[model samples]
Target: MTQQETHAQEAERRGSFSSRRVFILAAIGSAVGLGNIWRFPYVAYDNGGGAFMIPYLIALLTAGIPFLFLDYALGHRFRGSAPLSFARLRRGTEGLGWWQVGICFMIAIYYAAVIAWALRYTLFSVTEAWGDDAAGFFTGEFLQVSDPGVTAEIVPGVLVPLLIVWAAVVVVMVAGVQKGIGAVSVVFIPLLVITFGALVVRSLFLPGAADGLDALFTPDWGALAEPGVWGAAFGQIFFSLSIGFGIMITYSSYVHRDTDMTGSGLVVGFANSGFELLAGIGVFAALGFMAQAEGVAVDEVAQSGVGLAFIGFPAIISEAPWGAFIGVCFFASLVIAGLTSLVSVIEVVISAVRDKFELGRAQAAALVSIPAAVLSVLLFSSTSGLHVLDILDHFINQFGILLVAVVSMVVLAWVLKVLPLLQNHLNRNGSFRLGALWRILVSVVAPLALTYVLLDGLWNDVRTRYEDYPGWMLGVFGWGAAGLVIVFGFVAARLPWRKDTPMDVTDDEEVQA
Candidate 1:
């Protein structure tokens, strides 16, 4: 068959985004998530306050967007899911793609539970359900968290909402790309912005809002000299942007071949950062109000992750005027953001499975999401779920995602020597031209910065147990889970591709592009 015929066949087989606009919205939806809302504010505060923006922007420019462009180039040029793209890139590297799929698998399992929690919290905001003790309510009542050991006992509160989240995700995935993922993005992204923007506005009028802003934005110039601050900047950018994973690669593969990927990357990258800044403003303003109401310092109430969202925010909601509105907006934003990101994460697995096995979209969605939902509900609805989730998140992100990212970059740039080829593809149609600097950033600087962050995290984890959890708990959920992903990757790669799946870029295909 001619290369044009092959492209047409593949386009029919694998759905494309309806247009570049939908692709941008979908990409932005994936990039902006729970981290922007809860994590970035604290990372900024802890790193160097406002002064951290220097390194943050530097990391975004030099590392984050560059890596994002690399993912875009790979997916757009190859026009396949991660595994299929890597297989076409070079057969030996297919395992790297599966490695990413494995990471997403583990991530999706735990990530859904968090979204479930947020979903419940969104409803709870109406009545101020936590009453006076948000922390106790979250742990003792809601999660009913037990000791740090595995158990089959389930928490009804978490299980029901978790099922809801999984159900919604399956429907979206089965609906295929444009109608499901794209439609949700077009709707939810705007809703999220409106609700969260109102929440930020509400927060600014609260008493002591200025104090929170001051605490967050006050520059610690001396922090610029600290290597740890730079590391923190790069680490936050990496985690926040959703790069170095199969997500962007998979999403980009759905865009038309001639789409301006570089331009889209810039929009997504900047939009995510803009939202993070808005999050900082909103989160800290509420936190500052909490501190004033409790007659304490802003630092006393400041927290991140679950604590910030479920615990600290509840306390703020209980005190602030129009507090229920604030609570609903905040938690709803979490649900919206988390749901969008979770859909993208699950899609990586679905896309890879469909490509490798040549399954229909509905079949792939059901196969990938059902088992994931069952495992997610089973693991996270139990008393020990929190502990396991905590350990898995920490270890998997540090070892699984970051480690594989470094390895993928090395293989693609050094071993396979495909940087030039990808660059050519990007420059041919990209609005922003990529040249040698882009290559150096992807191959050298980004990896080196990531390596430092990875090694630093490794040394810390090795020196002492994460969160001082029992050794066995860390051993199983932490180290053992991370190791299993690598093993799963190589094993999955060994499985034969579907007979009809194209595994190579023919010479004719090269000329056609």
Candidate 2:
């Protein structure tokens, strides 16, 4: 049988999302994570405050959602994970899919550790256990963080929770799509919104909340002229929406054939942005209150990434009314958001492995999770683990994810000349018709934007040691980690695709075979 014929049969064996709503919720859950809550607010504030929204929204419509639609069409049309789907597109491109999946593998391991930290802090919020020195506690006392280059013993505080996180994720994967991933996302996404909504409402009433809102939305119009601002906006949209990780492709593969592809992409995009905007409001309001209490500038208290979540927010919680309660809700929301996204991240690898090997879901889950869990525990559970996580996360996201995205767009828009084909599929299966504009966005706008970001990032890295870490450390954890992703991608792609018990195609209308 031809490759298409085999893929057609495999579609029947691969499980599906139970409904359109479930699929959308899962997609939203994947998109709305720590980036929305911890990263977006800071990024918006720095890039021109309220003024940044213009560029951000522009990127979302032109680049973010367009790429989203492309992934949806590819996955729905091909009915496989990134490897199988890309292989279907063209024989040699299968390695790119594995490369994308490799990036996902890197993300999933470190991401679980971050989620584990949130879990620990949720319990710590009970008494503001970090006391007055939030930073000291996080690094010196709690983590016992070693010197950057030194490897320290595991910290139980991080390790115990990380194990739970891995187990929970494994359970969800093993539960199968509808009962496991779909069901959890349905519950978690709503709960995440409600919890954060209540936090936002309470925050809006706090003294100095307006100051935080001002910092978030008060636009410095002149900043718009800077190239960096535009770059930031585009970067934020790309990273925030969970594109480029084989996630949307993997998720959309399970979507029902009759589902509205265009509508689904729009819904996921808008939902992600909506949550991000809401998160900005809540985060800034709390920071404003913190700034007021400290008699400092909002920028002094504002931060992003692990610093913002663990240090700055803990300080804010320590002073607020019912501080303990608010702290619990805040960290709990982070855990929920992180877990949902983690599920999608791991699923990318799981789906790829299952498709490539023709293994059962449970078997694929075990193969992926066991190594990922071990790496999470061994590397991140150590006192130096946070340092390693920071370095790897930076390099992987900058060099790995962004580069893969640029290449994927190039192959689709230029190499294959398939934008028209993908556009037709979207219009036929979706309520909304994608026209010349969509094609232009994918072919012209997105690639240029992504390419600029990639170049800027490379320049920045070459100029300085990230965070002032030693050059050797950066080489080991930063560039070295990224290089390994490409190496593994080709290695995994070279493995034999399963031939036994080819998947039976229940519906071949959308599939090429």
Candidate 3:
């Protein structure tokens, strides 16, 4: 092969040895964080009580796994940043690729808004907020204080220490892939898992914990008929798995040809979803027991508020034996889990900047941090940050993940020239082949499924506009659109588009469809 061919091949080999491991753990850590803690138990409280699990699992198998495999195949197949994967996979038609990348990038920025919340909660933990005196503590000192407190007021003796714990994540990324992300994931992912496992063991031992577990596992088949239930299941699957976000594709770009992407994708997906299930077990069992003792069913705590985490969980912990200790475990797990996700989000911004602007590693790192920190402080300073985060999350999940899944399935399954890189690599290694059934899934069924998700999202928007949710929703929708456009503009600007740009076209490759 010529030198050019060799260099192209060499570029195809991205990521350090630890990159794949870091990618899997980091992705799983992002998926398993706030969803398992805040979202699942509350939604489950109302949606089916114990009955939602059936649909959630069905949605997972049908939608989540298929899309997970599809992204793994496409991201590693192209060996480029997400937008590049979509554009490069098929050469000339890069619009959809830009769209996917744009959506992912936007979500990444807004997700920092959520990480800001975790930072706030972590600060609260260090004070006496989770102690048996939590109610008095939160009501008097924590909640009542409006302006940002000193490290001492915010978290007492440990306030500065907690923020540093959160900020050290930025340091990890500053060190780059081989050293920073890999080192953290190796330690933190294991710590997260162990912490979750500890929570589960203690949760099961709680009185009436079995009742909540039964609620999570048992199914009311009648609830399956509710369109909203399916929507919740699908939404949860999309958000909780972190699917359709370009992070998977972006991370996959770092994979070496020798890496087992299918295996790795499964490991990450199952690890994430499994943690989610365990998290449900922990949270619901506690919620159920606590609710029973309080004489209200789980639905009593379903409101989305600052109290959701700060007041709600701490209240439960305060009522329990050695409650302060349990509260410590929960927040500890949250801090590590939050940082793992935080690093990935920051990396998304940094990766896009570096890829598009030809930035050095450190410059790209600082660029992501400065803006993220400023925006986070601005947003959280308002009472509305919590509500805004929820709204942005819904919009991002609905439009971003669903639509990317749609485009990705089409490009990889139909537009791409050959079997996706993972299949090719497996065959190259004489390791494993997906065979005809899996082939059909990658090429056709998966894409079709995403198309349904995509169309449903469009229809949801149209339907909602006619139905007219609150006026505040209009701002959310408007910002969501503007966000996608802004991110895509960044990506599109970076593409080598000459005025006479036929450069968009890559070499001719066969499209299977």
Give lDDT tens digits, candidate 3, residues 268-368.
76777777777778887777677777877566744333455667777767666656556666767776776777676566556655555655667777777
Model 1: per-residue Cα lDDT over 1-513, one tens digit each: 866777778778888789999999998999899999999999999999999999999999999999999999888878788898888888888899999999999999999999999999999999999999999999999999998889999999999999999999999999999999999999999999999999999999999999999999999999999999999999999999998879999999999877898999999999999999999999999988988898999889899998899899998999999999999999999999999999999999999999899689999999999999999999999998999999999999999989999999998888988888888888877899999999999999999999999999999999987899999988889999999989999999999998877655553335122
CA lDDT of each prediction against the hidden true structure: 0.92, 0.89, 0.60
Scored against the true structure, residue 91 in model 3 reaches a CA lDDT of 50
Highest lDDT: which candidate? 1
Query: Of the candidates shown, which would achieve the greatest TM-score relative to the real structure?
Result: 1
- Taking all chains together, each candidate's TM-score versus the true structure is 0.98, 0.96, 0.80
Stretches of candidate 3 above 4 Å error? 1-15, 19-23, 42-54, 93-101, 130-166, 302-308, 414-432, 439-473, 476-483, 486-494, 497-513
Candidate 2, 1-513: lDDT as tens digits: 875666545656788899999999999999999999999999999999989999999999999999999999888877788888788777678888999898999999999999999999999999789999999999988888998884748898888999999999999999888889999999999999888898898888778889999988999999999999999999999999999879999999998777899999999999999999999999999999999999998989989989999999899888898788778889999999999999999999999988887588899999999999998898999988888899999999999999999988988888888888778777877887899999899989998998999899999989877999888889988999899889888888788887663333324333332
| Pairs of residues at least 3 apart in sequence or in different chains that clash in candidate 1 | none
Instruction: Please report, as a residue range, the 10-residue window in candidate 2 with the lowest summed lDDT.
Output: 504-513
